[model samples]
Target: SMFVTNSSFCTESKECLEYLLVCKTDEYEVRHYSPTRWVSTDAEAYFMGVGAAMAFRRLFQYINGANEGGFQMEMTAPVLVKIPEETRMWEPAVYSLGFPLPAAYQEKPPAPTSNKLYFSEMPEMDVYVRSYGGWMLSVTSRLHAHLLTEELGRVGASYNHSYHYGVGYDSPLKLLNRHNEVWYVSEGEGSFTSQRLV
Candidate 1:
């Protein structure tokens, strides 16, 4: 079974304990974070994606490296999940899954808006993914995508779908400059490496 929660960061401490109880009994676990500490302002949206991707990469590497008994790690490209605005909770217990961006904003422009989170039926396919860090402007992101496509072709591994999900780690209120912003590629597949971004 999959579970979802929506809560504010300030109230997270209280809600987390409740989530832990549910997770203990649930067959599949997934958590969502919203009203996030990182989303302080609208301008930071673009860079936030990059930061999230990098964090995820590091987390994945650390978990996989330990490779404890019967533990297996699978990589995924980020997809935006449309969830209700009332969800909260910060960690993935077992079989954690989420889309990088809010679903309502997926095709919308970079503007102020909000939408309800909607869950959909699961797809019947699998994809490989790699994460990237640093800024992903038009020139850089596209270049990376192309390189990935080429490499995947050579290895007979290709993506059925590709998306660029950004996560903002810092609060946007403190920054008035672009340099203060960071972006991460939450999910995608190719020969791309986290080192390339560093």
Candidate 2:
């Protein structure tokens, strides 16, 4: 049972996605996550918040019994929003938001009723993470992502620049102690120089 229900940041979820802590620096943490399955949806918008909101609703419905089996599922923590690195002001970006399928549904989850929704299988990989407080709005998410990239550059960390993830562990109803993160995928195997957080 890799998935744990109790994590410091995942206060309200019944199940939280699991990851192995690889290293930590003053500004960020490095985590290794195993391959996991998720129910995902994509939305196109000029801002991350707008896209994520739409995508979230779609995904929420799926877990609430909008699937083929009409089977309901519990919510999971650390919902992931894949954000592309490059975007022009005039153009809208496509945001892919995902909720990790519960262990029971990971292997054979109900199929999504919407065409925009699908199942995504993430590969085992490492990521550079920066935690933040408050709402995961477009501005805040981008700000933290920029900050994380700066720290990564300063440390000479090798990571993927093409895209990153905006991770959230709380629901909108929870106002206090809201935890959010921005993640930059590691470049490849052996790309990190691991050292325990002191």
Candidate 3:
């Protein structure tokens, strides 16, 4: 069997949530989460969360890299940008915000009690995606929402009337961890764009 993975990040502070989603072909497994959604806003909350999510996703791939299977998989990492309010383009979808729980704050990983933290079914659709690197300050989710709105307008794609969710990926370890990258899912897809991480 084969597997695929992807990561994304938000360049603005308001788009703090980062996410990582992975799929396995053989077992048909899919998993995702926001690692830094528990820490309160401070100086480095946004970057920390993004870093954690990225790290976790890389760790996940590293652990599964040696598997031998007949199936094949691909991965994608997308960073959602904030859309401006002045843009009268795509319609806004469901929006949310949260902080990550630091390891020092929790003695152990929280037990899974609900599907909300794992995976939620999304309506099938197509979407445009962009990614970013480095740290962004004075950023907000509104910025990301606005960015998407403008992008849609540029391409003549109007936003659908529905709730869009943000996914943030992170690790339980500290932000110093390397290979930490955050990814967010802004919209569904009628098609997919896959790329490998170097």
Model 3 regions lying over 4 Å from their true place:
5-119, 134-138, 161-163, 170-198
User: Which tens-of-lDDT digit does each residue in 54-85 have in candidate 3?
Assistant: 43443233223412232112222222222122
Q: Write the per-residue lDDT of candidate 1 for residues 130-158, one digit (tens) a residue.
A: 23444434345445445555555666544
Q: Would you list the C-alpha lDDT of every candidate in the order shown?
A: 0.27, 0.87, 0.29
Ranking 2 against 3 by lDDT, winner:
2
Candidate 2 residue spans exceeding 4 A from truth: 190-198
Candidate 2 clashing pairs?
Answer: none
User: Candidate 1 at residue 159, lDDT?
Assistant: 42
Q: Which rank order by lDDT, best down to worst?
A: 2, 3, 1
TM-score order of candidates, top first: 2, 3, 1
Per-prediction tally of clashes: 25, 0, 57
- Report the number of the highest-lDDT candidate: 2
Provide C-alpha RMSD values for all models, in order: 18.7, 5.8, 14.7
Over the stretch 1-198, how does candidate 2's per-residue lDDT look in tens digits? 658979888879889988999999889999998877778888999998899999999999999999999998989988999899898999999988888899999889888888888887777789999999999988888899999999999989899888889999999999899999999989867332222111
